[model samples]
Each structure stands twice: as structure tokens, then as C-alpha cells.
Target: MAVFNPFLPSYQADPYPAYAALRAEDPVHFSAAIQAWVLTTHEDCERVLRDQETFSSSSDTASGQLATVLQQQRREFPLGEVPTVLNSDPPVHTRLRTLLNRAFTPRAIEGLRPHIEDIAASLLADAGRTGGRFDAVTGFAQPLPIIVIAELLGVPPEDRDQLKEWSTAIANTTNVLNTEDALAAARQATMELIAYMDEIVAQRRAAPGADIMTALVQAEEGGERLSHDELLAFSILLLLAGHETTTNLIGNGLLALTEHPEAAAGLRAEPDLLPSAVEEFLRYDSSVQGAVRFARETVEVRGRTIERGSTLLLLLGAANRDPAQFPEPDALDVARSPNRHLSFGRGVHFCLGAPLARLEGDVAFRALLDRFTELRVAEGGAERSGTLVLRGMGKLVLEV
Candidate 1:
């Protein structure tokens, strides 16, 4: 009877062992700690993701205690349960996603490569100037994505630090086991961020620019456009999704490389392996550990019946490492091909920022390897974030 306690420090530091145990003994089991049925198998998670009709993403569709808790939390949100791309299902999600997709065009993403490379080089240069040792989280990983996203969103450079603070506060509330204090801080941050974004949105509306923010503001399809509240929700979501996840990706990837010198050496020798290396990093330790979905109807899985409206915690990290789907799943192989990881999710709700994230990672890792000959973890190891939903290091000191 293995229990899932994600809040435990040990689990936060390393949850693969727990995921392995669950996948071996009970692939689909209910966990009282988070009050959700945890799905660990890659097949099970993939099925749920693909069958969005049966499993809804909206907090509104969520029933049982999960719905009750979400309702209470919504009351505190500045936008008040407005269905965004992340939480909504079907037609509403379809509409929102279509408009948002305008800003993330393939051309738009690829065009940012030069800018991303510049940002990475500048950050790494600053870190190098720090005389060989620096906190990678702050000096490199954290700021790289923040600056890139801020520029993408048309946010001014002076306001990025404040935005990062607000985004971090909001990210803390993503954890299922979040405390009252965290929720309170997140509420405050949300309110302030909305106010700040309202001004930017207004500016974009008045005068468009060559940026994603402008694209979002002007996005129209079949006589439908994002409402004011929807805009706010999207802007907030972009900041979180764009900044937080990639920050963790870079941090976690660097940590992994340092741990596996052979992999790092191989990557340096064959830089074309970068694309695959980034994918391997994503699979090895995903930035987003899990996602929540509610069963829209009674469903049978692994001889277990999940009642209608029951919440399911799809463990993406676990699924990535599931032995059945990935051969030698735990091994770090940068050149592994046909890698289909759930890090960007699947179906309608797949991460829209995937292109940008992948681009950023490619540039960041390349820049690091090109500039610094050696990258070693500092005296103390990574300080892992407490949030269970998102996995990342808050601080990772590095010696180059």
C-alpha cells in the first residue's frame, strides 16, 4: 500500500521512485493526500489526454470535493473562473486556442531564434563575468525565459523583475497542497498582474506592434475574438507557462548534464544532437510533473471505475519514465529517436509554447556549452521548488 505524498521534501526532490512504485504495483490508484485518482502509466495518461470528451479539463466540470475546492479558490481569483485554454474543454477551449494560436505561428516562433540566442549569450556572459561560480537559477535559468517572454509579450524591460515576482507567487498556488498564505499571496499577485496587464492590453489595442501581445489583441476568427477578461487570463497564463516552465526546463537540463558528464561531452562533440538532447532532458525530468483532469463520465480503467466528475491527476513525469512505453526509460540517451513525451501534453490541450520553449532550450544549452568549457554543480545541490504540479530548482549554484 504505497501512498503518494507529493508535499514531502523527499518526493519533491525526486518523485520518480514513487512514480516507479505506483506504476509497478498500482498503475491507477486513488490518493487521499491530493484527493485525486493518480494515473502513472504512459498508456493510461495518453488515453485520458486524447479522450478529452470523456475527461474534461475545466474546473467547472470537476465534481466531488475537487469542484468544491476549486469553487472556493475561484472566488478569490480576480477573473472569477473565466474558462481559459488550460482549464476549458471543447468549443470554448477550441475558440480560445484558435485565437491564441495566432501569436505562436511557426514563422513567429522561428523568427525569435536570433533574439533567443542573443539573450542566452548575454545571460551566460554575465554569469561568466561573476568569476566562475554563480546561481544558475537566478543568473541564467530564471532570467533567460523571463526576458524572452517579456519581450515576446511586449512587456517593458524595467517591469520584468516585478513580473517574475508576481509569476512566482501565482505559480506557488498551482500545488494541490498549497497553504492559505500561498493562496493569499497568489491572489494579491494575480490582482496586481491583471492591473498591470490591463494597461498593456489597452496600449496594444490602441496601437499594435510586432509582438505576440499585439497579435493576441488583434486576433479574430469567424467574427469571434477574446473578451477583455479572456485577454487578461491569457496574458497571465502566457507569463506562467512561458516563464516558469522553461525556467525549470533549463535548470533541470543543466543539472542533468552536470550529473551525466558523458552526456554533456557527447552533446559538445555533436551539437546537432541538441534537438534530441533537449527532448531527452524533457523526458528525463519534465518541468510539469502532472496535470489535473476530471472524468466527464464514469470510466473503467485497469479494472477500476472512476465515477463521473472524479478528479484524475495524470502524472506526466511518471508516464515519461514508464518502462512499457520507453525502453531503458531511466537511462539518459540524448540521441534517442521517436521520442513521444507528454511534456507538451497531447490533443487539444498540448502546450502552445512548445516551439518557443524548445527553441529557447536549444539556444540556452548551445550558448552554455559554447561559452563555458566546464559546468559543475556548486557546494550545495539544487533547491527544489515545493509545488508538486511544477518541478524545478529555485536555486542551482554552478561552477564553470
Candidate 2:
């Protein structure tokens, strides 16, 4: 029988096989260990994402282990409990998204391309100074996105490192099954981050700047502005979600290219394929492996009756690989056309930072390939992130 245990080391190493097993035998299976129903097929996952009324995004609707974690988080760190776009639905979510859209417009994002390209070049140049060997996670992947997001949020460049540290702490608690120690650390980090954001927001209000923070502070839709708590929550969410996923994308994409040299070579040969390659990278190994939702009412999925209030784990990584959606899902094809992968998810909560991430990935990959003639994994194996939901590398040494 196939098991849906995400905590297993083997599963962390490569979850696609296990995902494949569950999709074939039991697409909608409940795992007692995690205390949630796991959905593997693309269609079923899409159905849940699209029908927000039936599957809620709010912690108030969560059940079982998810509720326990959320309750404790709220009690211990109320700052993290605010109804931001990530955890809110409909009216609340609609308002938050609308305001955010005004601040994070496409033109604003597009304007950052030249800056992103410069940052990627600078990071690679610094790597070259390190005698041809460096930990890509720290030296290249992590800093590139951190710098970009920090500048966008009006954070000074020097404090980017500290911001990343706090962000990582908060992200550790993404999975409800995390250790108490992890939760405690995350709580402390949440407090510190909120305090810092409060100060920044005040500064932005006092003297507006050409940054996302200033735009957010000034943004108004129908004469409705974000409340103080809403502002803080949205800022915190942006900082956390903005860079972390893209960091993982770059790291994971690099690893994928390293494992499949032919794809890397192909990209180097035909530079126009970078965007398509980035899409494949997102599909093959997503930064966010899955997302959490609550069953608002009893719903039948693939003959399985999911009771109201039950927590559901929509396995996005698995869904992206479902043969019903993508042919030969296991194989990595850079030029896969009509690739409608759910790496950024679907429906109302689809990733807001998708374009930014794609741009960063394109720039990072192009810069790396153009600068270095060869790329190889170092002797020591890479270290994967502790959390299951936000999957990525902790440390991956590379030689160029």
C-alpha cells in the first residue's frame, strides 16, 4: 500500500514516485499521520482550488491538526493570524488583493528587470571571485531574490541579510506538524518582524518613497485604505512570500539543470528558450509542494466523501506531474508547450509574484549560463529545507 507521509527522508529526497503511487491507487486518500486528506490528481486539486466556497482558505475553517497549529499560532503570535490575502477568502481577500494590485502593478514589476539583471550579474561576479567554488544557495540563489524583495519593500540593502533570517524562521512553521521549538522560534521572529515593519510603515507614511511600501501606504481603492494591522500583515506576507519561493525556484532550477546537462546546454544554445525552461523548472520540481485548505462542507471527490471542516492537502507538485494533465510527466522537457502546470496554483489565490519570479529566474539562469562555461554539483550532497510545504535546498555547493 502507498503511504502519504511527507516527513520521511526518502520522500523529501524525491516525492514524485510516492505522489505517482497515490495518484494511481488512491487519488484522494486520507493520511492519519498528518491528519489530512491528500489530493494527488490535477483535476481534483483544481476543482478544490476553483471552488473556494466549498474549500476555504481561512484558518477559522480548518480542522484536525491544522486547526490545532493555527490556534496555537494565534494565541502565541497574533501578528501571524491577521486575515491577509494568503489566509483570507472573498470579501477580505478581495479587498486586500485589490489594494495590493495597485501597488504591485505589472509596469512596476517590469521596471525592475534591469535592476534584477544587474543584481544577478553582480552576484555571479562575486561568485567568480571565490575561486570557482561556492554554495549556490547562499552565494547566488538566496541573495539575488532577497536583495530584490528588500529593495521593493523599501528596506535598505544592508539589512537584507537580517530580513532573510527572520523570514526563514517564520517559514519554518508553514507545516502544522513542525516541532514545538520551530514554532517557538517562528513566534519570536514574527514579533520581531512585525515590530520592524511597523517602524518602516511609519517612515513610509511620513516621507513617501518610490517603493512598494510607499505605494502600499498611499494606495486607496474607493477611498478605502488598509488598516494598520492589514498593512503590517500584507507587508510581512509580501516579504516572506516574495523572495522565498523565487529563491527555491532558482536553486531547484539550477539543480534540475545540473542533473540534466542537456537541458542546460540547450538553453545556452538557444537563449530565447529561457522563459519556457523556467516554466519547466517550476513544473518539474515546484518550490511550494502543496497548499492547505479546509472542506467547508461535505464534498465527494473521486468517490471519497470529505467531511466538513476536514483539512485538505492539495499536492501541487504531484498534480503538476499527473499524466492526465502533462504527458510523460517524469521527463523534464524544457520546450514543453502548452504547459499549464499549477506550480503557481489556480483560482483566487494564485501566486501574485509569478511574473516577478519568472523574471528573476530568467535573469538568474541567463546570467549563470553566460558567465560560467560549466556547472557541477560539489562532492557533498545538497541539504534540503526542513519544511515539507515550501520545498527547496538549504545548502547546495556548486563548482563552475
Candidate 3:
């Protein structure tokens, strides 16, 4: 199969066609541009995500733009380490994940439901007062997650803007700034966040609070507390993963609802379906489009052999739309039950914040419907961000 740049703007706008072609003609196709084998089939993607031994997530060979960024600032980037929980295989991954799991306990997330609902309600009320025209991304999607993360991290509400600026500087795809500048900004952000966390940790050490940060500060494993670097990395991961992915979830789900009126009407009529609708939204258009993994040894997938040390890009978006896995794969079904999607990932490295994300999504969509009686796409089509790994709309203007 001929290799092409999947990061091109054209591909970003509509990757389904390319993904369909790949899944049909070359499910395990290798691309020189990305220097990784593309896994497009649903079964293959699940297999790769589940079997971490054969396919490593250590970021040993992440090429293209992300590779450049990681190589330049290996020590600073939490993900640069050989294997953080999100990027590690078992044992180490298991240990790290186990240590962090207490923070995201089901009771903790459930306890947060009221707070999340309140935040969504307040934001929706503001949107309603604006006479119906609002940028959904800015008005609702962005603020809800930012506030939730800020509250979770115990960061001052006033400082939330700076936190977002830092995250955007590092993660924004439209920023044409040089890699050095981006790295510098990321390093500065890391230091600032760490400094803030250090103070919070000190306070927590002196007198623990009920927040997750305090819990983490006081957490003990085999009579061991988390190292400073580990704590910092874990905090950064939680903030980034917590906000970035959920931001896209809200944005993408709203976009889907606006585009599909019948589905939206169904959701409005039956609010109970919102949870399943969120799941279907995840399946139809996932936030994390693909995850990178390194091949531990020679592995044959979809009739193609991937060499050891090579990178593999498991196309989550493609897998979600695989005709073999989903009936009427392209259509958006709000009531699609038994939706087993890899949007939150799978296996040992599954997303720890999945429960929180679901809760947030359900609250967000329900509040959105309740607040806006008439909703339509203010802008007909979505402008997508250019990042290959994360896929989301750049802006989604909606007339509520």
C-alpha cells in the first residue's frame, strides 16, 4: 500500500474515507510518513490495546511532530518516561495505575455528580441569557472541564485561565510557533503547576483535605508515598487527560446532536437516553482518534507483519466505525446499546477518568437540552484541529 501523510488538512477534515480505504485494502498498513503501521480494523485495534506485551505503549518510536516534541523535552514531558501508566505495559503499569486508582474511585466520581451538574446548569443559564447565539466550544465545552479540573486540583479559580493558556500553548494544533518555544512554554507551565502543587501538597501533608490531591498526598503504598516526580507527572496527566479529552467529548457530542435533529429530538424527549447517547457519540466520533504503541517483537496483524521497535498507530476512530463491528456504522444512533468502544481505551491502561467523563457528558448533554429548546448548527460544518493523535472540532458555533 502506498504511504501518505495522514496529518494533512484534507485528512483531518474527513478521515473516514481514508480509514475505510485502509480497513478494506490494508487493515495493518504501514505508512512511512508516520513511520508506524496503521491498525484500522476493530478487532485488530482491540487486540493491540489489550495485548500490551506484543505492542508496547512506551513511546519508544513515536515519530512525526509528537516525536520531535518528546525528544526535545524528554525529562519535562511526563509521558516521555519509558512507561507511565498510560504508556506502560503490565507490572509497572499495573503498579502505577493501582497507586493512582484511589483518586478516581467510583464513590469519589459519584460524589462529584452534583458539583458537575451545578457547573453545567450555571453555564447553561448563562448561555440562555445570551439570547441563543453562542460558541458551544467556548460557552460550554471548554469552561465546564476547566472548572472541574481546577476544583479537582484545588487550584484557585482565578488562576484557571493561566492553566488553560499553558495547556493550549503545548497542545494547540493551530499554533504555528516553533517547537523550542512550545517546549519552553511547556517547561514553564510544568514548573508553575508543580510549584503550585508543591504548596498544596505541603498543606495537605500538614493537614489533609477531602480532595483528590490531598488523598494522593496522604496515600501510602507498601509504606511508600509517591515520589515528587511521580506526583507531578500524575497530576499533569490527570489535568491534561481530564480536560482535553472531555472538552472534545462535549464539543463532538454537541456537534453530532446539532447535525442530527431526529436524534437530538429523541434525546430531548427521552432524557434517560443521554447516557447511551454519549456512548454512541463516543463510538461515532471519538475524542482520542488514535493511540501510539511500540512493537515489542515481530507481530502479524491483519495478514501484515510489523517488525520489532516499529511504531503502531491504532486508529480508534476507524475502529469505532468498522462495519464488521458496528451495524450501520456510519449512522449516529442515540439508543445504540451494547456500544463497546475503545474511546476510553481498553485493557490494563484503560482511562482512569472514564467514569468522571461519562458523568460529565451525561450532565452536560441533559443540561444543554433543558436550557435550549431550539438548537441548530450556527455553522454548517465543523473546523477540525490538525493534530493526528487527538481529533476534535476547532470551533462549533451553535444557535440555541
Candidate 4:
């Protein structure tokens, strides 16, 4: 049996080869490192994500690897007490998503296109004056989504820096490995985040604004509205989900483009292909790499029986690169059509910010190509975020 330890620094640096090996030989293998079943194939991953009955999405205390990983911290984490979209199932999940969609409707998100364009253009213009080089993660990619989401949520300009600081801490909690220090930081961050959101929600109630936060706070349907706990949870979810993944999307997508100059040249020549190029970048190197699910009942997959209450880690990265699902999956093809990659995941829990992420990606690539004739990776390579569950560049310096 081949070992699948994604936590190792070497594997974190380049996980594709290991993912490829798993997809080929051990599509559904047990990873002693994570102490859970690792699902690599696209089909398996889709089944696990969609079949919420057999596999639960309950983030905490679901008898899965997550529950086991942070047995102590979760019990005290303030966010754990409230039911959010990420941790809820069925009626609860359906209700939270409904209230959320009221504020995050397609039209509502699309309305921010002009705003996204402005932010992207401004960031790139500022980077341009910096002697033809800038750290994409800090200067552009990281701030883009934070500013956009802060605007959407009606967070005041003066408060966004603090919000980003809290969000960064919250996002850091879910490291690939559930270490004591990480969990401790996560617990503290969760408590602080919930409290901060509570304050903002209170303010929104008193003085409503034309923002998602206000809409979410006041959203009502059939006499059903978000309770205090629900509002706080949803706020936390929006704050974290809105920026974190999109930041990675831009960073990873730009980095991938720099690596594959042919694709970059094609996009530069035919900018219309930027949309497809973003999809390929997602498939080739996704932002959120894997997800965890708890088994609701004894389930047999790939001739192996996983007992009920067991933890399962679905490797979305590996699944995206499965040769069976994607031909020449290793190669980066900007114009690959029928690109049904599971980057935003599948089923109900599919990313709500997906539309916004796509819009942002389109804006970002255009801004980069339009501003600079030539973009090259800096000599120091990348200081990748020290986590496999979330593949992102912490410092992606680029030279033009």
C-alpha cells in the first residue's frame, strides 16, 4: 500500500505526482496519516460530496476525522455552538442557504462587477509603479476579494483592515494537520470572530444599509428569518468564505499562468479565452484542495467497507487530475472544453461565492495581461502556505 501523507513539506510543495499515483493505483485508499479514508477518483469524490445522507457535512462533532481531530477545542469554540451553512444538514442547511441567497443572489453578486473591475485596476496600477514587480499575494490577489467582500457586506472602510486580520486568523485554523497550536488559534479566532460579527449585526439592525449584511440581517420569508445565532454564523461564513478561496484563486491562477507561458501567450493574444483559462487553472491547481465528510452509515466503496462514524477525506485536487475524468489531466490546456472539474465542489454545498470568484478571476487576468506585456515569476519561487488542504501561495512575487 502506498503511503499518502500530504502534510509532509515535500508533498505540500508538489502534491500532484502523489495525487496522480493515488488516482491510478489507490483511488480509494486509507491514509494512516490523516487516520481516514482518502478518496482520489472524481466519481468517488462526487459521490461523497453529493450524498449527504451517507456522508455528512457536519463540520464539528460528526464522528468524522474533524470531530476526532479537535475533540477538545471544538467543544469550546464559540462558532461551534451556532449552526452555519458549512456545518448544517438538510432542513437547517436548506434554511440557512435560503436566507443567505436572499442577500447573495446572482444579480446581487453580478452588481459588484463594476466594483471588482475598479479594485483590480487600482491594485494593478499601484503594483505597476513598484519598479515592475510586486508580491501578487499581498499587493493584489489577497486584497482584491477582501475589499470586494467588505464592500458587499457593508463593512466600513476603516474597519476592513481589522476584519482582514481576523479573517486571516480564522482561515489559518483549518490547517491540513489538526495540531494543538492550530486548534488553539482556531478556537480563539472563532470566539473573536463570532463576537465581532455579533457587534456588526447589532449595528446593522439599528441602521440598515444597502449591503448584503443588512439584507441578511433583515431577510424574511414565510415568517422565517435568521435568528441571532444564525445571523452571526452566516456573517462569519460570508466573511471567511468570501475572501479566502478567491484570494487563492487569483494567486494560484496567476502563478499557473506564469508557469505555463504558452497559455499566458494565448490568453494575452486572445483575451476572450481568459474565462476558459481560469477554469483550466482551477482544474490544474485548485484553491481548496480537499474536504472532509463523516460517514452516516457503513458504506462500501471501491471494494472497501468504511465503518459508520468514520472520517473520510475527499481529495478534490487528485480527483480533478484523474486521467479517467480529464484526458491528459497533468497538462495545462487553457481552452479545454467540457471542463466539468470539481473545483467549486459538487452538490448543494457547491461554493456560493463561485459566481463572484469567476467574475473576479476574469477581471484579474484581464487586468494583469492588459497592464503588462510580459509577466514572469520572481527568482525566489513561491513561499507556499504551509497546508495541503488549502493550496495557496503566501508570497508569489512577480516581475514584469
Q: After superposition, how far is residue 183 of candidate 3 from its true place, in Å?
A: 3.2
Model 4: lDDT equals 0.82
lDDT of each: 0.89, 0.87, 0.78, 0.82
Encode model 1's per-residue lDDT on 1-400: one tens digit a residue: 7778786778987999999999999999898877789999999999999998899987776666556677777877898688889888889899999998877898999999998898888887767465677888898899999998898788999999999999999987777687899889999999999999999999999999998999988999999899999999998999999999999999889889989999999999999999999999999999998988999899999999999989998999999999898999999999988799999999999999999999999999999888778878878857877476799888888876
- Over 279-359, each residue of candidate 4 has an lDDT whose tens digit, in order, gives 988898898888888888899999999988888889999999988888899899999997989988888888887888898
lDDT of 2 at 47: 91
lDDT of 2 by residue, 1-400 (tens): 7879876778878898999999999999999878899999999999998899899998685678866687677667857667888888998899988988898788889899999999988887767465767788898889998999899888898788889999988887786567888888988888888888899999999999999889989999999998999998887788778878988998899889889999989998999999999999999999989988998999899999999999999999999999999999999999999899988888999888888898899999999898877778888847877466888988888876
Q: Is candidate 2 or candidate 4 better by TM-score?
A: 2
Global CA lDDT computed for model 2:
0.87
- Number of the predicted model whose lDDT against the real structure is largest: 1
Q: Per-candidate TM vs. native?
A: 0.97, 0.97, 0.93, 0.95
Clashing pairs in 4: none
Off by over 4 Å in 2: none
